[model samples]
Target: MKQKKPNILFIMTDQLRGDCLGIAGHPDVKTPYLDTLAAKGVLFSNAYSACPSCIPARAALHTGMLPEHHRRVGYQDGIAWRYEHTLAGELSRAGYYTQCVGKMHVHPLRNYLGFHNVELHDGYLHYARYGSVPYRESQHVADDYYYWLKEQKGISADPMESGLDCNSWVARPFPYEEKYHPTNWVTDRSIDFLRRRDPDQPFFLMASYLRPHPPFDAPAYYFDLYKDKKLTPPYVGDWEDTKLLKERGRIFDSLTGPEDEELIRQAQIGYYACITHLDHQIGRLLMALTEHELQNDTMIFFTADHGEELCDHHHFRKSLPYQGSIHIPLIISGNPELTGFAPHSVCDEVTELCDIMPTLLDIAGADIPDRVDGKSLLAFADGEGREYLHGEHSYGELSNHYIVTKKDKFCWFSTSGTEHYFVLEEDPHELHDRIEDPACRERIAYLRNCLIRELTGRPEGFTDGTSLIAGREYPVYLAEK
Candidate 1:
C-alpha cells in the first residue's frame, strides 16, 4: 500500500506587510487566527518580494525565478506570460487538481496559464478598466466576484461607493454587507470549490485574496477595532528628504507630499482592518477544511505577493526598496504527521517569493526544473540557504537595486547613484543610514560590488565592466528577443 498524497492550500494576500501580524509584534494590528497558525507552523521572518509589485512579484512566485530571469522588472500590464514551468503546471502534471480562486492578473485577463480553472477578481486595474478598448471586446470582462456582488446587491452596487481610490492612501469602511465584500466572496468561492472537488485525488487550491491591498475598505466592525487606539506612526528615516521626493512629481497610483497625521491614522486603521477581516475569512476556510476531514492531510501555506508602504519614508505605494514595501509574511503549517515537519518553529533564513514554487513541488514529490533560481525551503531547519538575497525594481525616477543579508541591507538608486545602508541588528526600523560612516565604508563597497555584479550584462546597460552606471532608462520588460 502507498501513502496518500497530502493536499495543498496556498493562500495569498496582496500588499500585506510582513509585520502586520500579531505574532510579528505589530503594535495594533490583530490577526488572532494567523497568530494561531504561525504558532502551529514555521514562520519566515525575513521573507521578501523581490520586485515588490503585482505583476513582477507574482511572476517570480509562479515561475520560481528572479525578476531578471522572469523578465518582469517593474509593474507592467498586458505582457503575455510565456513561462514553461509554473507552480500550477508542475503540480497539475504531478496529478494534483490545481485551481486558483482570485487575482490571476495575467494578460488577456482570462488566460488560465496552468490552473485548470481560475475564478479571478483582480480589483481595479486602471489599464484594463479604462483603456481605449471597448468594454465587451477588451480586458473589461466581468470577474466572478463583480458579478456575484451585482447578484447580491443589485446592478448598481459598486465597491467605490466608499469614496476611496483603489490604490490611494485614503481609508474607509466598506459600504455594503460584510458577506458581500470581495474578501469574503473569495473565501466563499474557495470553500465552494473544496465542497465540490474530486475526493479521491490530492488537490492544490490557491485561495488568493486581493484585499488589504487598497481602497482600504474593510467592514465597519473591523475598522472599529483600531479606531480608538493610538496606532504606531510610520517610520521617518533621517536621510529622507520629503521635499525632494515631492518635487519628483506625483506618479500614477501614489500620493504626493506629506499626508496629514489624521489621514495617516485612518489609513492605518483601514489597512489593519482589512488584514483582520481577511484573517477571519482564513479562519472560515480552515474550519471548512476540518469540516471536510481534510485538515489532517492538508499542507497549508500563507503569504502575500508584496508589502504596502503606508507612508513609510514618505512613500505611499510599492516599487521602493524599503522594508515596508518588500518584506512579506510567509507561514507554512499543517499536519505535523507529514515528513520533515516541525511545529511552533521560526526560520529566519532570507527567503524570496520565488522559493514558494520549489517548496510546494518538493512537498508534492514533483520534479523541479534546473532553470529554477529559487531553492526549496523544506530543509530550512538544517540552516542551508543563500547568504544574501538580491532584489530590484524600476520605480520611474526612483529606480533602485538592493542586497539584503541577515545582518544588514544595502540599497542603490540607479537614477542618481545614491546609496543607503542599514545595519539590521542595530536599526530594525531603518531610521538611520550608515553609508557615510567610516567604519562601514568597506562593507558598503563590498555590497555595492555585489549589486553591480548582479546587474551586469542586463539590456538596460545599468552597469559597465567595473561599476554600476547612473541614469539608465528603467526596464519594465525584457528587450524583444
Candidate 2:
C-alpha cells in the first residue's frame, strides 16, 4: 500500500521573541524541549514578522500574502476578514481535516475562515472587550477558554486577579492552579482533539497558544524559576532618545519608555515563566502524539506571530522596526521517513510568517495559490532565500518602514523623516545606529531609495517623486484595495 501522507502540527505562540530559546543562545530563558526539537529538525534563524503586530502578522500567515497585499498595514480591530483563500481552507480542500485549538484572532469572534472548527481564545482584545460595532457578538459571547475557565473556577475567576494589566509590563504569578491557566487549557483541548479526531484521514492541527504575550501571569513554580536569577539587562542604543523615558513613563500601556530596573526584571521573570510553562505544555502535546504512535508520521512546525520588545531600546512592545520587535523563531521538524526532511540543521535564510502557508501546502502536496506573496521555505531549506525583507507598521504618530538583509538593516521614521541603519554583523543587538557614517552613506541612500520605491504608489502618499514625505497619518488599513 502507498504510504499515508504525514500529519501536520502547526504550533504557534503570541509575542514570543526570536532569541528567547536555549537553542537560540538565550542566556536566561530555558526552552529545553524546543531546543531538542530544533536539534532534530531545521530552524530558520532569521524568521521575521513583516508587520510585527497581532492582526497584520496573522493576516500574512493565513493568506500567505504580504501586509500590503492583505491591506492590513497596521493594528486595526473589527475589520471583516474577507479573504477568499486561506491556509486552512486550501488544506481542507486537499482532503485534510484542519482544526484550530486556540487563538484565531479573526473578527466576528466566530469567523472560522477555513478551519473546520476553531476553539478560539484571543487574549484581551480592546475592540471586543469594549462592545464595539461589528464585534458586539463577541461582547455577548465568551470565548471557549473563558467559558471553560468559568466552569473550572467560579464565574468571577479571571486571569487579571493577579493585578497585572494584560498588555502592560506588570508581572505576577498566576492567581490559580497551574492546570487552570489558559496555557494548560489550550493544551488540554488540543490533546482532547487528538483523542477524538477522525483517524482514517490525515489531519492538520494548529495548536495556537496565547501566553508569554501578556498578563505575564505564569504559575508560581515557573515564576520562581527566574525571579532570583541574574538576568540580562535590556539593550540601550546610543541613538535612542532618553526623553521618551520620561515622556511616556507613567502611561500604563505606552509602547516605548524607560522602566525601573526591578520592574523590568520582574517582567522578564514573568515572561520567561510563561515561556517555560508553555514549553512544558508543548512537551505534553509531543508526549501525547508519541503515545498515539503518530510521532514518525507527523510534521511539526513551531513559530510565533511576532517578537516582544521587552524594554529593548527603551521600547516595551512590538510594531517597531527593530530586531526585538520583528524577529521571530521558526522551527520545522518531522519524521526522517518524510521526503525533504533535513535533520539536525539550521537554515539561516531570511524567512517570514507569510511563508508558512505555502510551506505547509508544499509539504502536503497541495497546489499553492497564484496570488501568494510568500514562497515555500521547504524548497529553500538548503538553498538561498530572499535577498531582503521589507517590514512596516502604522503606529499613529510613529509610523515606520524598514528593509532588512542578512547583514544589515535600514529603518525610516515617517513622522520625523529620520533614518537609522545598523550593521547586523558587527552589532546584532542594534546598540549603535550608523546612518551618519560617511563610509556607509551610499548604502543608506540605496536602502532609502528602495523604501521610496516600496511606498511610492501607496494610498497614504508617504513618498513623493524621490523622497519620503513626513507627518502624514498612515491609515491602519488601505482604503483603495
Candidate 3:
C-alpha cells in the first residue's frame, strides 16, 4: 500500500516577532504550548517573512512567489496580481479538501481564493477604519464577549471599541476576546472541520489567526498575567540620526517620547500579554487535536505573517525589513516517527515565506511548480544547509527589502533610499551599520545587486536592473502576471 498523505494544518499568526515565543529562547514571554510544539517538530531559527505586511505576505505564502512577482504589493484595492499558482489550488487539484478559515488576504475573489471553501473572517480590511472590519457585527469577534464588555461598569469604553475587540498583543486600541477572537474562531472552525472531515481523504486546512499584531489588547486576565512583570522593549538606537527611520508621518511616533521608557515598557507588556493570550488559544487547538487523535496524521506548522516593531527603532508598526519587522517564528509539528528522523532539530538557514508552499507540497507528496521561488526544508531540517534568503515589503507605509545568509544581513529602505548592512554573528542587535565600512563596501554592492536581481527577476550582471521604489523605471515589472 502507498504511504498515507499527511493532512496539512498551517496555523499562521499576524505580526508576531521571532523572539516572542519561549522556544525562540526568550527569557520572559511565556509560550509553553508552542515550546511543546517545537519539541515534537522542527524549528527554523532563521525563518524570515517574504513580505513584512499582511497582504503581500499572504500573497507570497499562497503563490510561493515574491511580492513583486505576485503583484499584491500593498493592501490597496482589488486582486491586482495575476497569480501564477497557489498551494490551495495545488492541494485541491490533488483531491485534498483545501479549506481556509480566517484571514487569507486575497482580494477580488472574497470566497475560495483557490481553496475549495473559505470561512473568511476579517481578511485584508481595506475599507474599515484603522484596517479593522466590524469583528463583532460580522459574528467573527464573538458576541458574548462583546455583550460582556458592554455590560462591564467603571471600565470607560466605547461601543465602537467594543466592536473592535479582536485579540492582538501589539499595543494599540483593543483587548483580546476569546468568544469572537480570530484565533478562537479559526481554531474552533478547524476543529469542527477535522471532526466532520472525511477520514478517508486527506485535508489541507490553513488556520490563520489575527493576533499579536497591533491595537494590542487581550482579556484583562491575560493582561494581569504580565501586569506586574516587567517587559523589555526593543533597543532605541539614534532613531532620528539614521535614515533607516520609519517613513515620515508614521502613526505610532506620536505615542512615544524622548523619556517615555515607562510608557514604552507598558506597551511592551501589553504586546507580550497579547502573544501569551494567543499562545493559550493555540494550546486549546493543540489539545483538541490530541483529543481527536489527529495529531499524528496532521503535519502542523506554526508561523507568523510578519514581525511588529513594538517600539523597536522608535517605530511601532510593521512594513519594514528590519529584523524586528521581518523575522518571525516558524515551528513545524507532526508525527514523532517522522520528527524522530531529526528530533528536536534546528535549521538556521535563511528561508523565505515562499518556501512554505514547497515544503507543504513536499509533505503532501505533491509536485512543486517551477514558478515558485522557494525551496523545500527537507534537507535543512535534517542538518543540511541552504544559501541566502530574501524578504520584500512594499506596503505604502514602508518600502523595504532584505536578504540574509547565516552570517551577514543587508536591509534596504526604499522609502528612505538608504541601505543597512550588518554581520549577524558579530552584532546580532544590528547596532552597527556596516554599509559605509571600507572593507564591507564590496560586499554591500554585491548584496545590493542581488536585491535588484531578486526584486526585478533579472540575472545578476543586468546593468539595467531598475527599481520601482527608487524611481528608476526600466521595464516596470508589474506585480500582476
Candidate 4:
C-alpha cells in the first residue's frame, strides 16, 4: 500500500515582525495558539524576506527565486508577474488540489499564478481602489470581501469608516462586529474551502491574511486586549538620521516616535491586536483540521511577507535595512516525522522567503523547477546553509542593498554610497553602530566587497565590477527584455 501525500497549509500574514511571536520571546504580544504550535514543531529564528516588501517578497515565495531572478527587486505594483514557473502552478501540476483562500497580490489583480482557484481579499489596495481604474478592476467590484461586506450591510458600508490610511501608522478598532472583520472573514472562507476540497487528492491551501499591515482596524475586543496595557517603547537606534531617513524610516511624525503619544499608543495597540487576532483565527483552523481528522496528515508553515517597523527607531513601515523591517517569524509545525526535527527545536540557519517554494516542493515529493534559486529548508536540520543572504530595495534616495549573515548585517545606500554595519549577534536591537569600531573595520570591508560583487553587471549601474558607484539610477522595475 502507498502512503498518503501530506496536505500543506501555508499561512502568511502581512507586515508582521519576526519578534512578535510569543515563541520568539516577544515580551508583550500574546500569541498563545502560535506559541503552542511552535512548541510542537520547528521555529526558524533567522528567517527573512529577502526583498522585504509586498510584491518582491511574494514573488520570491511563488517563484522560488531571488529578487534579481524574478526581476522585481522592489515594490512596484501593476508590473506583470511573468514567471514561467510558480509554487502553486507546480503543485497543481503535481496532482494536488491547490487553492488560495485569501490575498494573491498579483498583477491584473486576478492572475491565478497557477492555483486551481483563488478566493482573494487584498485589503484595500490603493491601485485597485483608485477612482480612474476600470470598474472591472476596482476594489468594490473585484474584491470578494468588499462585495461580501456590502451584501451583509448595504452598498454604503466601507472599511474606511474608521478613518485610517492603508499605509499610515494611524490605528483604530473596527467599527463593525468581530464576525464582519476581514481577519475573521479570511479564516471563515478558508474553513469553508477545507470542507469543500477534493478528498481524493492532497491539497495546497494558502491562508493569507492582510492584518498587521495597516489601517489596523482589528475588532474592539482585540484592541481592548492591549489598549490598557503599558506600551513598550520601540527600539531607538543611536545612528538614526532624522534629516534624510524620512523617505526610508519615519512612518510616524518623528524619527524616534510620533509627536502624538496617544496616536503612537493607538498604533501599537492596534498592531499587536491584529497579530493576536490572527493567532486565534489560526487556532480555529487547527481545530477544524482536527475535527476533520486531517490534523496528522497536514503540514503547516507560518510566516510573513515582511516585518512592521512599528516605530522602531521611529521607522513605522518597511523597505528599510533594519531588523524590524526585514526579519519575520517562521514557524513550521505538524508531524515531527515528516519535518525531520525534534519537537520544540529551533533552527538559526539564514533562511528567506525564496526557500519556501523549494522546501514545500521537496516535502510534497514534487519536482522543483530549474528556475528555483532557493534550497530546501529541510537541509537546515542537517546543518546545511549559506554563509550569507543578500537583500535590497530600490527606493530612490533611500534605496539600499544589504548583506545579512546569521551574526551581522551590512547596508549600503545607492544614492550617497553611505555604508552602515552592525554586529547583530551582539546588538540585536541594532541600538549601536559598529562601523567606527576598529575591530569591525575588516569585516565591514569584506561585506562591502560582497555587496559590490552581488551588484556587478546589473543594469542599475550600482557597481562597476571593481567598486560601488554612487548617484547611479536605481530602478524599481526591470527593463523590458
Candidate 5:
C-alpha cells in the first residue's frame, strides 16, 4: 500500500451480466480487462443483487442493508434516499476524499449520498423528461455528461437521436464517435479525478458507467465484431410453452424476447458488443492507475448494480428472480496482504450488493456501523457466510421471492402461486424445471420454508410464519419506510 490507508477505485457498470467476462468462460462476450482484474483478485462467483434492479440494488450498496431494511424492493423513481450513513459518507468520515463520477441514481439527480463531490450522469429517466419537473432538477440539466455531449456536438445533439427504447431488446450500432459515448466519458472524468486528486489524503473514486444497460448502442466497431458470428442461443425453460413466444415478444419493450432467432441473435450481438466496449474502457482506466503509479497501492473493486437478462429464459430486462437478472460480477483486486486472501481466488460464498459497503469499510479500517446488515467478504475468505441467499423483486404480477445456493434455486411468484426449481449444478442453464420432480421434493420444500421464514412479519404479508401465502400485494417500498 502507498499510505497507511489505501486509495479506493470502485468501479460499477449498469445492467451487466455475471457471465459476460472472458475469465468466467463466457463463449460469446470478450472482456479481457475484467478477466485480468478477476484473475488478480478474489472473484465472488456467486455474487448477487438481492433486489435485482437499479434503485433497490443501489440502496443495498450505499447503505449495506437488505431490501427489507432499505425499503426499496424494486424500480421506483423520485423517492428520497433518506439514509443518514452511507459507504461514501462513512469513508469520508474516515479521512478519505470521496468522488463519484457517474450514475448515482438517487432522488433529485444530485443527492450526494455522502460523497464529497459528484459528477452526475443518470441515463434517460422517464420521470425527468416530464414537463412538470423543474429544469434545474431534470436529468438533462443536472447531468454533466449531457452538458459535455452538447458541447462536443451542437447544443441540439442528443443521445436519444438513435431512436432506440431504453429497455428494448432492439440492437443498433452507435451513431456517434466512440469519444462521445457515455462509457468513454465516464472513464475520461475518472482519469481527470486522478490528476486533480489531493496527493496527501487517500481517496475513494467511483467510476460508474451506464453502458451495457440499453439503447444497445455499442460503437460500430464493437457491434461489427460480433454481427456476423453465431452467438450462444438464449435460454428458455422446458416448462415454457413455445407456441406463445411470439405473443410474449410482440411489443418493442417486451420483457420476454422475440420468437425470431435472428432478432434474438442480434440482441446478443449488441449486448456482448457493449460489454467489450466497457471492458476496453476499463483497460484505459487500468492504464491510468498504472501511469500514476497507484496500481499497486489502490484497492480496486468492480461490480454492477444488477445483471441484464439479455433474453435469457425469454426475459429481456432485470427485476426478476432469475440467474441472469440477479447474478452480478463482483471482484476486489488489491494487496493480498490487506485483503486476507490469495490472489486469483474464486469464492462460492452467496454474497450480495449489501456486502459491498461493509467490505469497503473493513478495507479502510473504518467502523462498521450498527445499521449495516451485511458481513465482510474479507472475513468470508476464511470460509464463512450464509449457506444460501434470499432475493426478491416487486414487479407487480411478476413480483417474486427466491432462495439460491451453490447447488440449487427455488423461486415463488408472490401474486400467483406459481413455483420453479432448478438444480443449478446439474442444470446451470435452468433448462429443466424440477419443481414437481419427486427427486427435488425435499429440497424444494426446505427452500420454500426458508422463503416463508424470510418473509415472516413483512408488510407485504407474503408469509404467515408457517406457510407461504399467495395473491399478496407487493409494494416497491415498505410502508413503514
Candidate 6:
C-alpha cells in the first residue's frame, strides 16, 4: 500500500502576544489546551511574524514570501496573490481537500486567492466604504464591542469621552454583537465544517481564529475568567523616551497619563480571556477530529498571524517590531511518525512567518516553489531552526524595521536615521538602548548594514511573488484609484 499523506489543521489567532500562552511560560493566562498541544508536538519557542500587521503578515504565511516582495504593504492596502500558487493551491493539486474557515484577511473580501473552498466568517475592522462588504455591513445589525458600547452598555463615550485622551486610531471602541463575535461564530462554522467533511481523501483545513486582537471584547463570561488574576505584565517602559525614534511615537505616549494603566489592564484581561476562549474552541475542534478518527493522520499546526502589544512597553496594538508583537506560538501536534525527529521538542531557533508555507508544502509531498523567501524547517526536525528572524512594519506614517539574530537585535527608523541596538541575551525586554554604546557599535553596524542591504535589495515598488499562480498581482483598488 502507498504511504498515506497527512492532513493539516492550521490554526491561527490574531494579536496574541508571545507570553500569552501557558506553554510559552506566561505566568498568568490559563491555556491548558495549548499547553497540552505543545506537550505532544514540537513548539518553536522563538517563532516570529515577518511583519507586525495583518494583511502583510498573513500574506507572508500564505505565499511563502516577504512583505517587501508581496507588496500588500499596509492595513488598508491588499496584495493580490491571485497569480501565485498558495499552500492551498499546492495541496489541492496534490489531491488534498483544502478548506479555509474564518478570517483569511484576503482583500476585496470576495477574491478567493487559492483555497477553492472558503468561507469568510470575519476579519479585521475595515473603516472604508467597503465596510459594507464585510460579514456585517452596519454596526446596527452586529454588536461587536463597539456596538455594545452604543447599545447594551449605553455608553456614549467616544475616544475622548472614554478618556482615551490621545488621537490614536485604537483609542475608541467599536460596535459589537455576541451573535457575530468572530471567535465564537468562526469556531461554530469550523465545527460544522469538520462535522460535514468527508474523511475518504486527505484534507487541509485552516480554522483561523480572530481574537485576542482588539476591541478586546468577548462574551461577558470570558472577561470574567481573568477577573481575579492580578494584572502582572512585563516591565513597563518610559514612553516619553524616544531618542532614537524619528517621530513623536504617538503610540508610545498614548500609554501615559491617567486611565492608561486601567485601560491597559482591562485590555490585558480581555486579551487573556479571548485567548482562553479560543483554547476552548480548539478543544472542541480537536474533539471533533478525534471523534472522526482524523486525529491520527492529521498534522495539526497552531500559530498566529502576529502578536498583540497587550500593554507591553506601553503599546496597545501591533505594528511594532518588539518581541512582544513579533514573537508568536508555533505548535505542531499529532502524526507521531513525523514528530519522531522533533517529538515534544522545544526549538528556540528563529523562524519567520514566511517559513510556514514551505514547511506545509514539504510535509504534504507537494512541490515548493524555489522563489519562496522562507526555508523549510522540515529539514531541521533533527537539527535546529535558523539563528535569526526578520520583521518589518511600514504602516501609517511610521517606518519601523527590525532584524533579530540569536544574540542581537537591530532596529532602524526610516525617517529619523536613528538606530536601536539591543543584545537579546542581556536585554530581553529591549528596554536598554545601546545604539550609541561604543562597546557594541561594530555589532550594530554589522547588523544594520546587513539589514539595510536586504531592505534596499528587495524588488522596489512591487509586491513579493505568491505561490497562488504564475506572476505577481499588484493592488488594483487603491493603486488604480
Top model by lDDT, which number?
5
Note the Cα lDDT for every prediction shown.
Answer: 0.86, 0.87, 0.68, 0.86, 0.89, 0.67
RMSD of each: 1.9, 1.6, 5.1, 2.0, 1.3, 6.9
List of clashing residue pairs for candidate 1:
none
Any idea what lDDT model 4 has?
0.86
TM-score, one value per model: 0.96, 0.97, 0.83, 0.96, 0.98, 0.82
Better of 2 and 5 by lDDT: 5
- The residue pairs in collision within model 4 are none
Which 10 consecutive positions of candidate 1 have the poorest summed lDDT?
A: 248-257
Which runs in model 1 stand beyond 4 Å of their true positions? 1-3, 134-140, 244-258, 336-341
Best by TM-score: 5
Clash statistics: count for each candidate: 0, 0, 11, 0, 0, 26
Give the alpha carbon lDDT tens digit for every residue of 1-481 in model 2. 2336778999999999999999999999999889888988988898999999999999999999999999999998878999979999999998899999888887777889899999878877777776445433563364788777877787653456677777888888888888888899889999998999887888999999998899899999998899889999998889888777778866767776445778778878888999999999999999999998788889999999999999898888899999989999999988644525568788888999999999989888899999899989877755758988989999976789999988899998888888899999799899999999999999988888888888888888888859889888788898746
lDDT of 6: 0.67
lDDT of 1 by residue, 269-384 (tens): 88999999999999999999989988888999999999988888878878888899889999999866552558888888999999999999988989998889998988676788
Compute the lDDT of residue 344 as modeled in candidate 5.
93
Model 5 stretches with alpha carbons more than 4 Å out: 242-244
Q: Is candidate 3 or candidate 6 better by TM-score?
A: 3
Once model 2 is optimally superposed onto the true structure by TM-score, how far is the C-alpha of residue 73 displaced, in angstroms? 0.7
Candidate 2 error regions (>4 Å): 1-3, 132-136, 336-341
The TM-score that candidate 2 achieves is 0.97
Q: In model 4, how large is the Cα lDDT of residue 114?
A: 96
- Model 1 TM: 0.96
